[model samples]
Target chain A: MKHKPRLPQGLLTTGSITLTVLVLFATLPGYASIYTVILLAAIFMYIVLTLSWSIFSGPTGYISLASAAFLGTGIYTSAIFGKMLPLPVVVGIGGLASFCLALLAGALTLRLKGIYFSMFTFGLVELIKHLMLWFEINLTGTRGRFVIVVDHITVYYVMLVLLALTILTAYAIRRSKFGLALQSIGEQEEAAAHTGVNVTLVKVSAFAISAFFVGATGAIMATRWTYIDPYIAFNYLFSFMPVLMAIFGGMGQLYGPIMGATVFAYLEEILITRFPYFYMLFFGIILIVSVLYLPNGLAGLIQGWQKRVWGARYVHP
Target chain B: MSILEAEGITKHFGGLTALSGIGFHVDQGEILGLIGPNGAGKTTLFGLISAALPPDRGVIRFKGEVITGLKPHQVCRRGVARTFQSVKVFPNMSVLANVMVGSFFGRPNTVSAAAAEGESVELLEFVGLSAFAAIPARDLTLANQKMLEVARALATAPELLLLDELMAGLNPTEIGLAMDLVTRIRDRGITVFMIEHVMKAIMCVCERIMVLHHGEKIAEGTPKEIAASKTVVEVYLGESAYA
Candidate 1:
């Protein structure tokens, strides 16, 4: 069979423009109220986290559960530096630290395949969290550190810019040689390797890229919250949430994570407001149903539906 | 000097010696045919040379470099590319996308999108798959899938191409087309080494033939020489079948 170019036009133009406008409006000074600003911040953070996770886990199927560990590393590294250094420097340090940590993780775990890799990553997160607790004296002075707040709007804008950058980077990687290599590995590792794709290097590169964004987002997140602790930084729920969002959005597609984050955030808000005790249960059910019926997630389901409709029309005409 | 050489290759699976002390060489741009019975270890030999399996003892030299235990990707980057006996194209991706994968990542450095696309299209055209470029690989027929596999390997721009039973499930017409394609590949200055069970295709296309029995090389020579070998006949027929 021959290759076909099937880029969606709507996604390239109208969808991107609308998203940019919406993000800009949300972060604009004196535009959204303080409460709305907080909500927007939460949504953006989730989107960034989900997109970062999708980079490695979605296309390559590595399924690293160590995202929160790297995120925490970034959060704490930036939080420590932010106390002493400038904000931009702190964010840079966070990205560097997270990237280093990802490299370490990749080196140790790249040899493992499938579920074993996932389990090892999950363990790494737990190990990092405990190590953070053990080294409390040096890291937190026996207590959690806090960054004094001076500019909420500045932080909001920083996040918006970072989110845009993450999306752009993801899009670039998707179309680049590295992206194709990673996708081939995800589809069939042995076959990809036989065809000359350096599987280990590709996986490691992906993990590092994922770490850079997750870490930057973590640094921003710590500043937005004005507090940092290993408990919240290495939260298992945070790691799992991004995976769910990626799966919900459409695994390897560019906008899947964003769509997933938007839906997930809204769902959490609605369910928590109406039935706080049962919200978790409701969320689980929704995820199960989405996976069962739309195994490719929302983006795939929608694409499949569109193809069917169009195919029927062509046949009938 | 031979373009590709294997020296003292051996592999063991627990107590089973899949291959023991096997060695051979292929001249540049030559179509070297390999034939063996089910347990003769032809696939294992391909795996060892291609770096899919590490040999217990052996040295593989491609273009005169010792590539004993390089990883599969490393071997490919060193100008050796291969296709699996079983069809292994990326099923979910479009046929064009599958070939583009080779052009994009087959070499170490990145190729431009236009260049990659052009190369991929040329490969598809060479393999007679230009018409199905936009279709998903899963939608292709068995024969076309095998052709696509060959196209993908070619996109890697390897100096030597290894094909594994590409004609196993192909019809006679498809087999003829594949043989023609193999000849064209050789005409383009890429050496070809293939494993095959179809005697007719091998005899028609191969410059020389290597025969294996019970993981050992029983004979190696031209089609006329290999056909008349006593050991080759013994391996093909059990003692009773030959009698």
Candidate 2:
């Protein structure tokens, strides 16, 4: 069958505009009342987290398993700082703290390649969790910390701004020389290095930037929830969920992680309510199926189908 | 005086000596051919000189400054670039993008995108792969892949290029084209140190030749000297064939 390769101009423009509107609407006073607004805010936070994960584990093939450690660092730093200072200042401090933590982690773990790198990151999260637990006396008497009640609108707007920044940064990096170096390193490290790329610097820089975004999102997350405990703040599941979303969308492409987070979040909301006990199992099965049949994730599957349907016309007439 | 000098370079892979007390010099604007049988350490010598691997014992001097033990990128920045026997072009990237990586990272003042793009286009045209510029590198045939490798190495603006088996898999026509390309590369005032098994291509383009047998230098001279050397003939054809 003959097919025409028509670019979906309307759909592309509308989809982008719709996403912007929806994001901005989340900051409105009466978008969906306070409860749904908070839920949407949480979704935005996940979007940032998933995209941050994509910077290293997705396109760069680093496969970090300790994203939660950076997230926790930001959450705890912001929560404690907000208790003593202004919220905006606290968020900035959170980003700095996370950057330092990531620098330390990167220095120690960047030398370990492939699966060893992954395991080192996994151990890092566990170490952070244990340290938080062990140093209970230093962390708000071990019961966790809380921020004084502030306007929820402030939290919403802060997260919105942060999300926008994260997306823009991801897009910029995707098109930059640094991005090409990262992709080359991911595909073949030895080749990239021989080609004059500083493979170590590129990998570490991506990891650090990835940590910055996830950490910033984690800071706002603590404020939005009005509490921060190491258990919930640095939950291993927090790291797993974003990695899953990134894999579910498409790891290497910019928009894939965001799409993955949206679909995964919506699915979680629907299925968790109905099969709360089997929710993790459902996630597991979906991951298995996705990995087996759609290795590039849902976005790639859709792209493949689109090409098959429309690409015929572009061939020799 | 030599532009590049390798003095007493020895490499050991545990108990195995890959290169033993090898010394050679490459004059500026000269094409030096390195020839050997398999496992004779031609590629390893390239690696050691290019800083892809550190030699166990060596002092490499470029422009009268020691460059031994420098990292590959640092060596490249010092005007030394090399290709692998196995082609190592960034497989998933477009041909232009692969060359752009070289221009952007190996050269200064290449941070501007327009300059990088222009230089990359020039390099692709120089290597006769301009028509395949937009194609992914993995799609190129072996000969084109080898050409792309050379093009990418050239993008670094190196003073000396180390090409490993640039004509290994090419047919006679492709070999002729590659030989002409190497000559043009030399004419650009860049020194060429090439490792090749294609005897005709090596003799046709190289001003001097060095021979390695089991990681040791057995012969070094012009092509005629090498072709007449009893040691070179015996090493390649064996004692029975030489007899």
What C-alpha lDDT do the candidate models reach, one value each? 0.84, 0.83
Off by over 4 Å in 1: A1-23, A137-143, A224-227, A304-317, B108-110, B237-243
DockQ-based CAPRI category assigned to the predicted complex of candidate 1: medium
Predicted candidate 2 versus true structure: per-residue lDDT over A1-317, tens digit per residue: 00122359955985699688865675475655876666667778889889988877765688888789988988888777777888777778777777788888898779788899989989888899878877875644666777556666777778788888888888778767888888778766776777788877888888888888778777777876676677887899887888889988987567789899988888888779899999889978988998899888888887777678889544321
Estimate how well candidate 2 is docked, as a DockQ score: 0.52
lDDT of 1 by residue, B1-243 (tens): 599998888899999999888999999989999998997999999998889999999888988899976888888877888999999998877888888888877777768888989999999999999999988898999999999989989888899999999999999999999999999999999999999988889989999999988778889999888877778877773454233
Predictions in order: chain A TM-score: 0.89, 0.87
TM-score of each: 0.92, 0.92
Q: TM-score per model for chain B alone?
A: 0.96, 0.96
Superposed Cα deviation of residue B51, candidate 2 (Å): 1.4
True contacts kept of each: 0.76, 0.60
CA error at residue B99 for candidate 1, angstroms: 1.4
Candidate 1 local lDDT, A61-127, one digit each (tens): 8888888888898788866777788877777788888999999889888889989998998998899
Best by the lDDT measure: 1
The runs of at least 3 residues in candidate 2 whose Cα sits more than 4 Å from the true structure, single-residue gaps closed, are A1-23, A137-143, A147-151, A224-227, A308-317, B237-243
| Model 2 agreement with the true structure over B1-243: per-residue lDDT tens digits | 689998999999999999999998999889999998999999999988888889999799998999997887788878888888888888878888888888888764456777878888999999999999887899999999999988888888899999999998899999999999999999999999999999888888999999998889999999888888888887873565333
